[model samples]
Target: MAGSAEGFKEFATSCSGRLFRTAWLLTGDWHLAEDLVQETLGKVYRAWTKRSRPDDPVAYARTTLVRTFITHRRRRGSAERPSDALPDLPAGETDVALRVTLIDTLARLDAKDRAVLVLRYWEDRSVDETAAELGLSAGAVRSRSFRALDRLRAVLGTDGLTPTTQNEVS
Candidate 1:
């Protein structure tokens, strides 16, 4: 088995990008995203050094990310207020409009709802996996998923998901 320190360094270097993206989606703030990833990686490294290392480090790290996000949201004075100003995206990014709209809609949801959407659709995890990660029952995961999708559709409106030109419609 690889030394825990070496293994963690390798894992963090290789997986940081994807983990950052997930954290960004969960936190809805670039700064918070970076902080979340750092905190999660620290937790993952500590767990990796333990006697019983997780069989799947990536999955464990992902779970840690979600759990950390949830815990952070639950702490006093941690609730974030929505800002009127939008952050600038990088140049030459594809589908900027759509991305902004989706992020805006996601920002409207509470932390747990946002987490459910990201984990289920973005991470492509099963109901059971999401349930376990969020510390909810499978039934609760399904109910939350349904409610989250409905909220998204309601908020997105016709202009958000629909094509402007009829010819583009499938």
Candidate 2:
């Protein structure tokens, strides 16, 4: 029991930042990302003893994070309207504006589609791995990837965003 507890602590320390970054990209809110990361770590810790390998702890944690995000979105119901109020932005000009805009566009997508994008592009997971992680078939992943890319292109438009590869879309 003590050994498992120590192992979980080490895993948490090592994977928390990467997990938080992924969560941030998914949610677009730092506080929400922190909360999601904390919840995911707690769940991972609970399963630590049962987990077989230490080397892929990050993968385990990431899968947990994605599942948690999906579950949370489902519970919230995608139909709930976002509030009109916007948070104040900092006064500095930045090169990441387009990236932030892209993220905002991603937020407009369905939770599963957003997860597909993150797993495929940000995490650079192969279609097979993403399908396994999401409990989806490879064909489903490919279909969703195509639809999601089309939606992103429609929402963000083709001008400002660089053209996505056909392979990426398909």
Candidate 3:
């Protein structure tokens, strides 16, 4: 698969789950996350056919996912709604409550802030990488990251997911 020019199916198959997790973090809606993943894959597939392969396809997919999510958020009709859609958990999982609270807090954030936080923290990208993906200055990304974390701390502080637990999740 490594040498195949038609390797996008393999690439997409391997990376789509990771892409969907980031998308879900960004959008906080199951259906929207799936749509965002499909769109990111479509873009990657086009690039895979028409251009040279990315040196780092995982990074490329994550950038595409973040940009697509921000683009979708810019549309007037693309507002996120909580769905009954929940990720399937393993049996006897006790951490669902914290996860739910965290996602709900994330969903309350502004779109760009949420993007910044997801890329910088959840994906563990460097400041420069996150700024590049979101098309922001390094200073801007830094500012947003600080403020977004503050917002998360504020909301999650009162929502039973404290700073320590949140840090662990991060």
Candidate 4:
């Protein structure tokens, strides 16, 4: 038990930042990203305590975070309306305008489209891996990736984010 806790602590300490980054992309808000990471780690910790931790904990965590994000999106009530105007950001955020623009554009995307884009482009995940994570066939992942990028291009006015290739993200 002691060893298990220590191992879990070590894994969490090392992976939390990466997890947070993925969560941040999945959710376009810092606070929400933090909450998502917390929830993901909670799930990982439960698995760890069971001594049934995955052989690849990193992959497991990533899958868990993605699944949790989509699940929450599905379950969340539509009572909360998104505001067009972004809140005033705190100091010291690099590339504020760029980040805000990208996040804002991403926020406009459908949940599944956003997930596909984040996994395929942001995470640099392969088609098969993304397919497994999102529970789609490889062909489906490819189709969705293409459509999602097109949707993103449409939303960004076709001039803002035109990647050279389907896999490339600008």
Clash counts for all predictions: 0, 0, 0, 0
Give the per-residue lDDT of model 3 (tens digit) for 61-132.
Answer: 899999999898899987655589897875553566777877888899999999998888778899999999
Residues 1-170, candidate 2: write the lDDT tens digits: 22377767887888899999999999987887898999999887766766354456688889999999888888857446578998799665444666777789889999999999889887889999999999999999999999998888887677554644323322
Predicted candidate 4 versus true structure: per-residue lDDT over 78-159, tens digit per residue:
2375789998885543444655676788888888778888888888899999889988899988888888778767766766
Q: Which RMSD values do the candidates have, in order?
A: 19.9, 20.0, 20.0, 20.0
Report the lDDT tens digits of candidate 1 across residue range 1-170.
43368878999999999999999998889998899999999999988888888899999999999999999899997886779999897555356566676778889998988888788876779989999999989998889888987787787664555434211211
- Candidate 2: misplaced stretches above 4 Å? 1-3, 51-55, 77-170
Query: Rank order by TM-score, top first?
Result: 1, 4, 3, 2
Which of the predicted structures, 1 or 2, would earn the higher lDDT when compared with the native?
A: 1
- TM-scores, in order shown? 0.46, 0.42, 0.44, 0.45
lDDT of each: 0.82, 0.80, 0.82, 0.80
TM-score of 3: 0.44
Query: Weakest 10 consecutive residues, lDDT, candidate 3?
Result: 158-167
Question: Over 4 Å off in model 3, which ranges?
Answer: 1-5, 80-170
lDDT of 1 at 6: 82
Query: Which prediction has the highest TM-score against the true structure?
Result: 1
